[model samples]
Target: MKQSKVKWTKSVGWLLFLMAIGFFCLQIGYLIIQPRYQVEYIDNRIFYVINMLSIICLYMALLFLLTWKKIWTVVVTTMVTLFIIVNVVLLVERNKEVKNISSISPNLQQIFAIKQDTETGEAMYYRSYYGILSRPKDRLEPEIAGDYKIEWLANDIAAFTYEAEDQTIQQFIGTYGDRQEDSMSYYYVASQIRGKWGADNAQVERQNNGIAITVDDQTELFGWDNVEQFGTLAIVLKKNNEAVWAISLDENFVANSEEIEPTVGNISLYKATMEENDPIVLAYQGGAF
Candidate 1:
C-alpha cells in the first residue's frame, strides 16, 4: 500500500511537469514567431495568467517528486512568485497604454483593428484572418490618428475614414480577397458586372444584391433573385418569372485578359422579347469587379 501511494504521487508529479514543459515551449515558440509575424491573442491578459499558473504547477511538481531542503524550497517559491507578480504588473501597464478599435468584415472572415497609443496619440492598423486559434496579424502602413469610421464597400472590402494629425480627413482601404482574380464561385457574372455603367441618357448600377436601371427620369430595380446568367457573355433579368431585360457583354471585350482592366468593359442592354428596340451600349465607369 505504501509503495503504491508513492508511485501514484510520482505519476501525478510527472504529469504536471510535462504540462508545465508544454506551456513553456508554447510561450517560447510564440516569442520566436512574434517578430516575424504578429499573432492576435483572444485574451492577452489570460495568456499571461495561464503562464503564471503553469509556473505554480511546476513548483508543486518539484515538491511532490523530490525531497528538497526547506530553505531552498522557500527561496525558489518566493522567486517564482515575484517573477509572476512582476510580469502581471508589466502586462497590465502595457495594455493600459493602448486603445483598440476593431471592426469585422461583412463575411465575418476577417478582422481589422486600430491600436492607438494613449500617451503619444500614435496609431497603427492591423488585419487578421479570423480563425479558431491565434491568427496571424498583418500590420499595415500609413500611421493615423483621431476617431475612425468604417464602411463596408463590399463583402470583403472595407473603407476606413479618419482625421489625420494635420486635421485632414484621410481614407484607407482594406481589401481581404484577391482583387485581380475571381475567387468566388456563384457570383462570377454579378461580381464582374458590379459598378456604374452609362449609355446615351441612361445609367445602370449593378450591386451585390440587385441592379438599378435608370432611363430618362425613371429608375427600376432588378433584384438578384430575378436575375439569371446565360453562359459567360449574357445575363437576363426577369419579372414575375418572365424575362424582361437581357444584358450581354460586347463581343470585342475579352474576359480574363490581363491587359484589360476587369472593371473596364462594354456591355449592351435591350428588351429580352423584342428585338425592335436598338440595344443600348453602356461603358463601365467605375466599381469593384
Candidate 2:
C-alpha cells in the first residue's frame, strides 16, 4: 500500500514566488528614481517606519515558505502586495533639496551669511543690486539707446541687500511685437523693478504674454507676467532705497483705472530714482515698444 503524503500542491508556492520576484523587481526600479538622502536627517518619520515594516514582511514570507505552512501563499502574496504599494509610493514624491549661500549687501560692498552652493558646491550668493551688471558689449544699438538706460542710484533701506543701483530707464512708447535683443536688459530691468507713483484710475493693458500699466503721469512699464508677483520689485525697494515706487500694470501691457496711484513709485517698468537731488537713475526690467 502506498501511503499518500500531504498531497500538497506546489502551485500556491510557485505563484507566491513569482509575485515576490515581480514585486522586488519593481522595488529595485523605484529606488533608482527616488532621491538619495545625503544627510541622515529626514523630514517625515512615518516613511522610516514604513521602510522597517517592509523588511519584516519580506522575512516572514520566506520563513513561511521554508516551513511549508499552509498560509505561506498568503504571506508571500501579502509581501508582494506590500512591495507593490511601497514601490508606488516611493516613485510618487521625493524630498526637496535645501542649501545656503553668502549674502552680499545690495551695493556689493560687503558679504554676509556665507554658505555653500548646493549644485556647484561653490560659495556664492546674491545680496544687493548695485548698478545692473552689464558687459561692455551688451550695450543697446545707438538709436535704441536714446530711450532706455541703466545706472546706479542711492538707497534708503541702508541694508546691504537694498543698495542696488537704481536703473533710470524709458521704453518705446508703444506695444512690443518683436523682442529687442541688445536692449533685453532694459526690458528685464523694467519688468523687475517697479515704480510706486501712479493714478489709481489707470489704463492696464495685457497682450502677447506681456504686461503694461500706468502708475501716474510720470511712470509706466511692460513686463513678463510670471515674475511680477515674485517679490522682486518690492524686495529690492525695501532693501536698498528709502523712497519706494510701484505700478500695477496689466498682463497685456494694459493700464489700470483706479482713483489711487496704480503705480508704486514714479513709474511701472520704467523706474526713476532720487537721493537728495542726485541724478535720476532709471532702470528697465522688461521689454519696450
Candidate 3:
C-alpha cells in the first residue's frame, strides 16, 4: 500500500512538470506570433513549440521509467518520436520558403498581389499626383527643437500644399473644392496628375478615361542624389485638385519611417494622408517585400 501511494505521488508530480513545460512553451509561442513584424521570430516560435512538445513526451517516459510501467513508457516514447519527426519535416519546408521570399521576384509579387491586381477585385491603394509617399518626411534632428514638419513641396497646379498637425502636406488628386459622389470620377483626376509628374521625373505613364496606368520610370529610385528610397514611390490619384486615393508600389505608405520606432526600410508603417480608408497592412514582417 505504501509503495502504491509513492507511485501515485510520482505520477502527479510528473504530470505537473509536463504541464509547466507546455505552459512555458506556449508563452514563448505568444512572444513569437504576436510580433507580426518579425519573420524569423515566427519561424523560431514554430520550432520551439515542437521542441517543448517533445520534451513533454520524454518527461512522461521518464516517469514511466521510475514506475517500470510498460504502458506509460510506450506512450511517452511514441510521442517523442512523433514530434521529432514532425519538427524535422517542418524545418526543411521553412528554410525553403525563406530562401525564395528573400531572393525571388520579391518586389513584383508584393506590388501586384497586394494592390495592383484588379482581377482580385481588391483596392487597398490609390494612385497619387504629387509624391506624398515618395520621400521620407523631413524631420528635425534628435537634439534639435524642431519636430517632423511637412515643410515644402514642389510648386504645381496639379498638386498643392496643405497643413495638418504642423505637417504641411502636398495635396494630390482628389476633391479639394468639393467631394464627388462617384468615387471613380475622383480617381480619374488623380491619375492625370500622376501622369504629369511621371513626365517631370522623366517617366512615361498611360492615362485612361478614369484609370491612369503607370509604367516604369528610367531613373533609379533608391540612392538617387545620395538619397535612399526605402519602401516605394508610386502614383497618387486625384480629382478636383484633391487626392482620392494614393497607390503604393510594393507596400503601403509609411510615414517618417526614418524616425519611427522598430524602424525598417519601407515597412509601410502608416499612411501620410490620414484618410479614414488608408491602404491595408499586408505584413509588417518584411518592408516593401
Best by the lDDT measure: 1
Worst 10 residues of 3 by lDDT: 151-160
Model 1 local distance difference test score: 0.64
Worst 10 residues of 2 by lDDT: 133-142
TM-score of 2: 0.21
Q: Sorted by lDDT, highest first, which candidate order results?
A: 1, 3, 2
- Model 3, range 1-289, lDDT digits (tens) per residue? 9999888877876776677577666557655654552222212324545565647655664665366578867876787778767777776655444311111122222111011112322212222222211111222111111121121111111111233233333332111121122342322222212222232222322233333223244322211122112122434443433333333332222233222333222211122353332232222232211
lDDT of 1 by residue, 72-160 (tens): 98899899989899889977876788665667776777665666677877666555543412443434233455555665444454545
CA-lDDT, candidates in order: 0.64, 0.32, 0.33
Model 3 regions lying over 4 Å from their true place: 1-66, 100-224, 229-289
The RMSD of every model to the true structure, in order and in angstroms, is 14.2, 18.1, 19.7
Clashing pairs in 1: none
User: Each model's TM-score?
Assistant: 0.43, 0.21, 0.26
Residue 189, model 3, lDDT? 22
**Which residue segments of model 2 deviate by more than 4 Å?**
1-19, 27-54, 66-209, 212-289
Q: Between the candidate structures 1 and 2, which one is better when assessed by lDDT?
A: 1
